[model samples]
Target: MKSICGDLLLQRLGPEGLGAFGKPLNRGLYECIRGAILDGSLPRATRLPPQRDLAAELGLSRNTVMYAYEQLLAEGYLRARTGSGTFVADTAPESYLNATAAAITDAGPRAMPGLSPRGQQLLANASASPTQWGAFMPGVPDLRRFPHRRYAQISARLWRQPPPEWLSYGHGGGLPALREAVAAHLRVARSVRCDAEQVLITEGIHQAIDLVVRLLGSTGDQAWVEEPSYWGIRGVLQVSDIGMVPMPVDDEGLTLPEADAGRLSGRTEPAPRFIFVTPSHQYPLGAVMSLKRRRALLEFARQHGSWIVEDDYDSEFRFSGQPIPSLQGMEADAPVIYIGTFSKTLYPGLRMGYLVLPRELAGAFQTAHAELYRAGHLMTQATVAEFMQAGDYAAHIRRMRPLYARRRAVLAALIERYLGPGALNAQGSNAGLHLVLRLPDDADDVAITAAARAKGIMVRPLSRYYLGTPAQRGLLLGYACVPEEDIGPAFDVLLGCLGECGHAAHVARIG
Candidate 1:
């Protein structure tokens, strides 16, 4: 056993072995042994060499070996037997050991656990980017300029002396203070008609949409989504087993047919149980739903007994004209679930968002939210509440609005300069973090997007946002996170890719 121990240790610990040359020898030995144990090179319950023998073999002082063994023993990595030598402890938990065994045994091709139909659909329809932050990555804010210092201070202060209840599982509706703050801000800023009681906090629009889908409708129920809509919401609907009817969008937003035609004639699909829209600023395309359209939608929903989900994400960043009031607040008792997120206005990592539910539905959604997800994060909510109360939230938006506007202008100018007129058309630049660059009818947006990505420019294919065959071919170029200086260069790279795709000719044309 002793002879075999030396060979095993020497083989495992390679040439410049146990001790890091410049560091303390004992600490280095300790780290090497710890790593070996963690990596399963030293199996659980394997006997370790006696301290004196190990010291002799390694030419180390007995005390040093003893120290390392003692530390390992104290940490439960090794167990000292009364009459026997030290062995690796069985402290590797059952779960860990089982997982390790499974990994080893299942190394070859094996039947993997099958996903549900819905799970398979989710995997097939997955649109989340592998890398979220970089040049021209759409839908991300400029995190570099975020007020981290102030937020950190507030976070630290709250954590130091948090309320007793706050440390526990929070209210399903969210932190009271946060709900009030959000309600007050929404009423004033976005004209959302809601009080604190109606504000149900969620992880973000993702979860908010999930709750609405689960609570209001059942599996196989029909819902209406824009022709080219936000893919995230489409995913939620699909996973919920809800059938989605893709409604086309014009310059005025979702173009719904007359209710009588939609319902009576078999030409159009039957009225959906719910309608999902981004009316404040249409996603990817940047068209505001006209007041007439908004009223028409509300009337349609009212007549059809359908609920509306207005995802007013990034509405606060509007660059031109007065900000639009929410569709939810436009009429009295409008059956609209107004969803907003701090992810865009603040930061995505915060994972805070809220829904202004209809008065009667709030209680049920709150109960289900608690039952299903078990709400917490009161500390984060409280910190955000303070930030809003102190007027920092509003000030941050004020500071970023112009900065984003400049970045938008730079990207737009580059497109006009490089791509030339009639080469590519850019739309939806009046508001939001991104805009749509419409390609020619013959262009393959998916191939163009892949080409752009290969050049280190991250742009989404406009066709990917559609439920069925895309009506238009284009790219969704996000300029929010890209610095003003980098926007031109990134778009130039993209233009080069476009030229390669034969979409843009190298003719000199005036902007």
Candidate 2:
């Protein structure tokens, strides 16, 4: 060999490589030389042939070889010594190639590096369903009925005449216009005591919960979460590494624990720092927190210096009279943080909700929220503001209430018809999108849930919602997404999935 194989580049470049298809030879030559160096066809430090000699060998002009070499040199793909020829630079691309190959070989039998321990733990306890929308899918709205025309019209209009901050990442406490609108709506509809300044907009209820818990919660702080509560909220707490004490839920909502945590556990937990409750309508089980209990919760929080996170979920669709007023508005300067989501009222994908914080702490939380999530979506927020201010939001809620009411009635009847009257758990049936269908204690709710999912219905196992060993067994069946006409057919499908042990007894009595 003449010091180094100058023909290696030519061998890798191939017969049709540089001049193929009438492509520009200079650029092609550059790429071919670079590729050879990158792929190890031309080993590092291997000197290339003289430009004139290489051009003559390849039947190209001297300028072409010079151009490719000059480009490669300028781009660090080649190095030149004072009197020596062009050579491939000592790049570590080969190490990467070797590592990739080694990884493939090692991956076959090895446990690869996985997520963080906390991340792995959070995922291991996850309960979110793969399929979100189907028969009896809880918390999903009727997607067909979303007011797309108005939202699009407003969105297009905003984009057409865009303002300076139309899409800006400003708004520490969310867009002022949207905050004002939310404040007005909550004051009127929910009786939430807040000015626009107190409203902290968020992506949704989960974000609101997470924000509160992370900011208000501290090391060794414990939160009183309702037993048989929303799993999503619990997941957030677990990820934050905050301890939770599952308080029971009865018809009155999250029941106050009779004994101190230390007394029960034989170890003193720091006096609880937060209390989470769905006071408007209890989740999975529809019980409104009584005014007495609400007052007591307020007093307890006052005593313990705890912040009560009141999730006013699905309070708008009450079949009877007006929805319950917020726990935040219960007493002046009450230690309650009222949170609500547009997911239930509008649509889940809308991904907007708000927190009505205490006026004393609102600004600090707003700054923290801005720093944390880097809140934006001014356009969407503004559109919703316009919609609510113009009474369109209330109008949508007005229309949805009766529609959901009819579907709920239809589903309830079918449950009573097919699964028997006793199977329809009356506790959570009166309001909200979903109701519980009780099963016997020994019944396999998880198996029933799986079977129903296989058959294209989606009811949740009640036992999964519990923070402790489940007190009872049942299934949560949502009627909001299911149309009136679809309820009977869906329940009939679900009924077929139920085993004879718990279901047939009820069915037999009916028969």
Candidate 3:
């Protein structure tokens, strides 16, 4: 009998058993043993010492040890058999064993170094605790609310009056009608000037980034990324083994580290092949690049013979002020590769988005895309083309913009009233479906997130987005999916948790 067995027994028991304890001592013992079992520190089938022997080791009553074991027997996580010693349950989750085995295999001596670095990064970023948020987080539109009735009507009409080649694959660029509509949408909405031929439809912005990376940047080429930018882009760059030069971002979007006449000055190093930015609305920080900075960036690109990857992820949801002109529209030397997606504005499930690349890179990207998919699916592309042509897509964006803006406002006001300054200083509040809340320095974002989940509030910590230093701890609160009424109470819960975590006093200094 050992003192450790008492600890191990408690972990095998569930919360029900732990809560049933009438005394604090029982609760402590119950929790200790329960944790050990769940963590597998106490292997299955380890025989428990006799009750009297265990009681002697832990200085607990024999009755206490017996009672704990009996409670564990009632739970399916463990099992007992008469005349046989207690053993770990044979019925442990199959997936658990499979996962453990896979880990061992992956780490075998023969495994190559640097293998799965991307997978490792993904694991590090994945949330360890339960998320209070639902599946349709912010930045995700309600596709169910899409006007299916109207789209159905248009789709049916297109089917009836089919072009003889309607059944055939569209041009590698995209369906002409869809591209034309996108061109028109860009001109009127985003102030982008481009013909239908310039738009190359792909799956979404992620694929668009992939295409640009493949076509323009070679392996080991350097790419400048905005700090606290889109995580997917960071992941893509890592997987590609591309060198990353992190340019600091301010409230006015990405500020080149150096000043240059045409090239961004300060980089004594060779300029990156391209710099990736979310100019219309900066990603996590939500800073819109001013006209001056935009001009500087383009001039720098031109001087260095670099390209710019502009991810206009949420340009459609401009809440105040007119939409900004795209850098690609102002390109004098085909120096910008602008990527836009229907995923956020339309529906993510549509899997339709396009890249307006500089003419220099278009032919090569088209070749890469062709080899990757042979050709894009004809049916879905055709359906999407019809959706865009009938003006249904434009109408949907027009209808949802104000609705999301209202939600954004509600979320901002709630943050002000309930969380005060301590919880998060909401940035990027002027537009976009979500806002970033700067957390206190002492706060453990991971811990705060877990505590919030315990109270049924979902939020994302800003730390998850960064690859370098933990820029600032905060939550990425998405309002698009959350109902307007819940905004206030959600903050109330969040604020209450912040107070309990000893962070309330820091609230005043947060923003």
Candidate 4:
């Protein structure tokens, strides 16, 4: 032990760091030894030098070294065996030093691994907002208004005496009561044709879409997606290696001729295995699929053996006429999977969503869901079931609809008043939590959105949702999460940004 210390000590403790003799010698020696132990220069379990020898080497009084050694011993940094000299303690500090050294060694230069081609594609198409809740950040509900105390009371009651089965892994298809509640609610509210047995609960729309893409389509299979659709769906499909055919959408909803032409023109690509649509209220653009388009879509899918995924997200907040009936319920056995979530209705943290599947496909989906991801969260499901069964869910929606409508009205009124009708055209504002503000053809939506973000206003660029060249430039301004009082101020900030961009463009044209 002494030999080890002798070999390393001189180089480890430089002359400059060690104080001159008789000038705070004890404190200087203590600091140097402590630093050595902390830096791993004096390894764990190594015996420190004898006080007499250390004092002799440094030409210091023996008392100075003795005081330093005593301080270290008292601090538990060094331990003395009855017959053996002092050694470094095997304590948390020593272990931390060793761990830090190992980390540094492992960080040595090496080739960093790369993501798979599919993963790279997903990354390239990622569109998640950096800030989830704020002014003009789309798809986020105002969680502040949620009935937290009521939900907490229910949660506490359920946890006080949880069912033994619920304490373990839950059924692949969610809690039976929740399924029944969701089925009953949908049947009456959205006209979705489904029974409790046909509803499969998922984490959210993302997981539901993932399950469909994996189960129904093979890798590289074509899928018809509404151009300027939800970016998240695009990422999910891309990661699954499904080829996406971007179909244009007008006020009526997804156009059928473009998809039909692609199939009939002998494009050499495989027929689309699925068509994903937001029929009730299209995301970002907010167009409700017309009844005519709905019938045509169903017929086309039936003929081509393609499935349709109807993402009816946020359809409950419609301010106009009665809610549109789901496309799945429009035709018998329409090969449609209807998805709805509580993220918009309640809160996103609930992470509870359901799929209304065709009777024939229910069993397969349930089995696949179990095998792929063992579903849990039975307690939360049970609580939500109670919320729905007790009529709380319906009452809550009725209460929130008007509040969201008022906020939407304020946003629309401000947009028209500030930007004028010709400066920006608002599309699909009759329903949904967000509206698309179309800018001039030459405007740079991305640059304008970035400028808004710098001013603490959150807005998504419309062009980011498109796969091919964007036909129009715009911003997706969400009004649901923004408070009524803050809406005008937030829009004021956004207006300044738009003015700056417009000024820049005008100057560039003159140049």
> Best by TM-score, which number?
1
Query: How would you encode candidate 1's per-residue C-alpha lDDT over 1-511 as one tens digit per residue?
Result: 3555556666655676665335677876765666667668788888888888988877778887888889888877889889898998876543445665223233688798899988988999899888788888888999999999998999999999888989888766999888999999999999999999999999999999999999989988999899889999999989899999998988889988755643734444667899999999888688899999999999889888899999999999999999899999999899899999999899998888899999998899899999989899989899999999999999999999999999988877776676655434433638899866777767898999889888899999989999999888888888999998787778778879988998766332312
Q: lDDT of candidate 4 vs native?
A: 0.82
Candidates ranked by lDDT: 1, 2, 4, 3
lDDT of each: 0.84, 0.83, 0.72, 0.82
Q: Tell me how far the alpha carbon of residue 399 in candidate 3 is from the true structure, in angstroms, after superposition.
A: 1.7
Which digits, one per residue and each the tens of the lDDT, describe model 3 over residues 1-511? 2556655554444445434555665555544554455666767776666668776766668787777666666764467777876666755444356643223123546756764867896666554333323421556676667888877776677678777665765556776777787887887777776777778888877777877777667987998898877777877777777888878788778987565465445556677897999888888878889888998888777778787888888888888887777877875555887889887886777788888765666667666787775555555666777777767778888888888888887776666665574544444637777887777766787787778777777776677766678778777777776666777767778778878888755756765
Task: Give model 2's clash tally.
Answer: 1
- Of 1 and 2, which scores higher on lDDT? 1
> In angstroms, how far off is 30's CA in candidate 4?
16
For model 1, the stretches where C-alpha displacement exceeds 4 angstroms are 1-110, 261-268, 421-429, 506-511
Model 3, which residues run further than 4 Å from truth? Answer: 1-136, 155-171, 259-268, 421-429, 454-456
Flag clash pairs in model 1.
none
* Per-prediction tally of clashes: 0, 1, 14, 0
Model 4 worst lDDT window (10 residues): 502-511
lDDT of 4 by residue, 1-511 (tens): 3456655655555665455334586887776677677677786798777878877666678998899889988987788998799998887354645664223234667998999877877777787877777899888888898888888888899999998998777665899999999999999999998899999999998999999899988987999999878888888888888899998988888987635543745356666798999888877687788888998898788777889999999888889898888898997778898998999999998898998898888899998888888889999999999989988889989988999899988988876666555434434747778877777768898999889999898999989999899987788888889999999999888888988887433322211
